[model samples]
Target: MNSSSPIASLTKHLWSMMYYFVRTYIWLSLIMGISITFLMAHLVFWYLDSEQLERFVSSASQTSQQLHSNLVTIFTHSNNTCSEQNLITMREDLWRAPLIKDVVHIQDGRIICSASWGNLEAGLVLPKPTIVWPERGLQHWRAVKDPIKGDIQVNMVSDGAVAVLIVPDNAYASIPSNYPNTGFILSTEDNRYVFHASGPMAPENVLTQSGSSWRLLLTQQCNTSSKALECVTAYNAAPGLFGKGLWFISVVGVLSLAISALLHSSILFVIHQKKSLKRALRRAIATQEISVLFQPKVCLTSGRTIGIETLARWHDKHFGHISPDIFVAIAEKNGLMPQLSRLVIEKALYQASSLLKTDSNLHLSINLSMSDMSDPSLLSFINDHCSGHRIPAHQLIFEITENSASGFEGIESSVARFTSCGYQISLDDFGTGYANLSWLSKIKATEIKVDRSFTQMIGDQDPYNRNTLSAIFQLLKDLNISTVFEGIETQEQAEYILRHIPHATGQGWLFAKAMPIQEVARFINTPNSSIQHNADAAR
Candidate 1:
C-alpha cells in the first residue's frame, strides 16, 4: 500500500473513530435491541403455550379431584354395605355426574353391588388403587374389563372398606374435543395418585407434576399442534388460576389489573415496600429486633416440657408484626437469611446458655435453612457460639424441614459432622411436601415432626384415617426415629397421639403457643405450674 497524504491520514483517523463508536455503543445498542425483541416474542409464545398447558392440567386435576371426592363420600357415607334400593339410587345419581360411567361397591376384592349391575355380579376383580396417600384415602383405582359394563373402569377405594366406586374409562377419554393438543396423564405409580384417561398422546410423551390427588402432565407440543388451542387458552379450570398465563401481559390490561390491584394493593400498601423492607430488615439485624420465641415440646405421657423450639420473631415498627413466614421468605429470597440466621443463632445461644446454666436437661431447638448449612464456616460458626457461650452442642437441636433435606444432598457428610459434634437433627414437617423414606434415609435425622394434617385427622370414627395414621407412626417407630406430633391443638388429639406412641413428643397449641423469652423463662422456672394455665392459646 502507498503511504497516505496528510488529508488522507485525517480521513482514516475519522473513519476509525466512527468504527470505535459503533463497536462500543451502536453495536451494543443493536444487540440489546435484538435481545429485547426476542424476549418479548418468547414471552408471547410462552404465554400462549402456558395458557393451554394450564387449561389441560387444571381441568384434568379438577375433574379427577371431584370424581375422587364423590367416590369417597358415597362409600364413606354408606353404612354397612348398600341395600338393593340404595344401590339402584346410587347408580342413578352417579350416572348424572359429569364423568360417571359406572359406580360399584366391592367386598373382599369382588364387586358385589355396581351402578350398572342391578342384580350384582358374582366376581369382578378390580385393579388396585392407582394412588394412595400415607394417611389420605385410596384414589384413582382402576378396574379392567368390567363384569357388567364390559368397558374398562377406574375405581376409588374409600379406604378400601365398605365400597369401591368405579368410574368408566370414557370418563377421562376425550378432553372435550373443544380443547385440543392439551391432554394429561393421571397416575398413582410410586405413591403418586395420578389420573390418565386417553387423548393427546402416549403416557410417556407428556411431562408430569404432582399435587394433592393427581399429577398434571403436559407435552411440549401443547401450544402449536392443537387445533383447540384457542378454546383451551380461554378455559380456566383450577381454583384461583383463571387466565393466569396472561398475568404479566394482563397487568397492563383491564380485568387482571383490577384483580391484581385487589391482591397487591392490600399486601403492598405498606409504604416504600421493597427498599423499606430491606432497610427495615437490615436495621432489625443491627438493632437485634429479632426476638426469640420458644415453643415447648412436651412429652405426650408426662405432659412436661422436654424441649423448646427456638423461633425468630420480627415485628417491624413500620410493618407492625410481619408474619415470620413472609419475613423469613423475603430474607432468604433477598440473600439476607444468613445474616438474619446468624443473628438468630447468636441470640438463641446467649439465651440458651443462660437456660443451660439453670437447667441442664433442657434442649434448645433452632431451625436451619439450606443456606445456613451451605456456609463453609457454619460448623465453625456454630462451634464458636457454643464454645463462646459455654453451651453443650447436644442441648441444641438443629431442626431442618423435610423439603430442605434433599437440598443438602452433597453436604450430607458436612451435616454428619454437625450431628457428630453432638448437634441433634430433627426433620420438621414430616408429612408435608414430598417427605418420603428416600429423603428420610439421606439425612442423619434423630426425630421426625409429624405435620398437623395427620394430627388433625385423628378421630374415633375415622377408621380409614386412624389405621393409616397408626401404620405411618409405627413405620417411623420401627425406623427407631423419635416422633413429635406437631399442631396438637386439643386434649383429644394430644391423648390420641400418646395412646399410640405413648412417649412421643408433642408440640403446638395443645402444650403452649410460642411465647416470648420472658414468658418462656417463667414457664421453664415453673415447670409444674400446669402448662394449660400458662398457655395463652390466642398466640
Candidate 2:
C-alpha cells in the first residue's frame, strides 16, 4: 500500500488523532494528579522558609541586645577623662569584648584615649557623627576610615564620653554561609535605618525606605538601656522565577512529578488488569507487532527539526491500543526490555538510514532501559545494527530516564562506553526521579530533557514556581550542556523557554504530533512544513 494513497493517508490521520487524544488525556491526568502534590509541598516549604527567617531574626535580636548591654556596662564603669589608669581599664575590657575591636574615650567632640593606643600623643579631633540618637545622647560614625588603623574602615559608636570602634566584617560572623541571601540591618525604633556597624542589609537607598525590590523577612526591636534599636533582616524579594525560593519550588516540583508518575502507573495498572498484559506484551515483541513513531524535536531558535525521538506504540487486536507505559513496564518486569529495546533500536536505525544518509546533522533518539544499560552486549548490539543500517553511531542518541539510570549501579561507565563509541546520551525526564544534582556528573549526559511538568511552569508567575524553573534553567546553562524541553503545548510556553533558554530545542503538540515513518520523512523533507511554520509563528 502506497503511504500517500487515500486509504493509507486516512489510516495515518486516524492514528495521529487517536495518539493525540490518548496522549492529551494522559498528560492531563498527570497534571491533575500532581497539582495537589505541588500545592502541599509548596505550603510545607513556605512554612519552613518563614520559620527559618523568624528564628534567625529572633536570635540576631537577642545577640544584639546582649552585646549592647555589655557595651553600656563598659561605658558606665569607665572614667570620663582620658586618664592613664582609665586607659589601662579600657585595654583590660577589650579582652572580654570579642566583637569590639577597640574602645576610645571622647570628650568635647574629641578622641582623647583608646584601648589599642593607651593615650593619644595628640588628641584626634572627632568629626560629626553619621547618625545621632538625641533621645539617648548616642552618636554613631559609620564606615569611618581611620589613619591610625592604616586607613582601614571601622564603625564608631559613642555616648558622648566613650566610644567603641568595631570591624564591619566581624559583625556578621554569626550568619551561616548557607544563608547567602540573608542580610541584616540596624534601624532605630522610629523605623529609620541607622548607619550602624552591621551595615545596610540591602542597598543604602532600599534600606533607607521601604521598596518593592526587597522583602523584609522579620524585624526585632529591643532596648539597649540607652535607646531602642531594631534588628532587620531581609532578602531580595523580587518574586523572581528562582532565587531564595528555589528550595520550595524544587520540593514541590519533585513531589509533583512523583505523583504524576504514580498516577500514570496506577492508570495503566487498572487498564491491564482484565488481560494478561505481560504475556501479550511478550508475544507482541516476539512477533514484532509493536510499531515505532517519530516525534520531531524542533530547535526553538532556528525553527528547524533537528532530531526525532522514537516512541513505541502497540495495538493489540483484542485489547485495542496499549500505552507504551503499560507495555514497557510489562517488558521490564518480565525480563523482556533487552529484546524490546533491541527490536526498537534495530528498526529505528534501519528505518532512519536514508534520512541519516541525506542529512548528517539529523539524529534519532532512542530510549534505553536499565536492562539495556546493564547488558554488556548492548553497545555491540547497537553498533552492529548501526553498521548494517549504514547509520553512523554519532547520529544515534540514547535517552535514559532518570529513574532507570539511577537504578543501574554502573550506569556511568555504561553511558560512558556508549559515548566513547560516538553515541550521545541524553538524560530524559530530568527532575522526575529521585536522582540528585550529583547524578548529572555521574552519567555525564550530553543533553538533558526538561520534564513536561517543568515546561508547564514556564508562564507561572508564582515566586516559588518561577524560582524553581529559573534554578533548573540556570544550572543547565551553567553546566554548558544541551537542553530539550518536552510537552510544550502552547505558544506562550515555547516563547517563554526560548526567551529564557535561547539555545534549547523543544517537542510538543504545538510543533507536530508523533507520526508514521512516511509522514516523518515528508515532514523532515518539506522546507516549509507545519512544524517550521508553527515555530515561525511562535517567534
Question: Considering every candidate listed, which one attains the maximal lDDT?
Answer: 2
- Listed per model in order, the count of residue pairs whose N, CA or C atoms clash below 3 Å is 8, 3
TM-score for all models, in order of appearance:
0.49, 0.49
Q: Give the per-residue lDDT of model 2 (tens digit) for 398-517.
A: 897644434556777878888888999888888777444656777888888888999999889899999999998888789888899999898788877777777889899988889987
Candidate 1 least-lDDT 10 residues: 225-234
lDDT against the true structure, per candidate, is 0.64, 0.74
Q: List ranges where model 2 is wrong by over 4 Å.
A: 1-275, 402-408, 527-539
Model 2: which residue pairs collide?
A: 241-466, 241-467, 242-467
Alpha-carbon RMSD, each predicted model: 23.2, 22.3
lDDT, candidate 1, at 8: 92
lDDT of 1 by residue, 14-92 (tens): 9999788546654444445455544554456456655666666666655565665565456645554658777766765
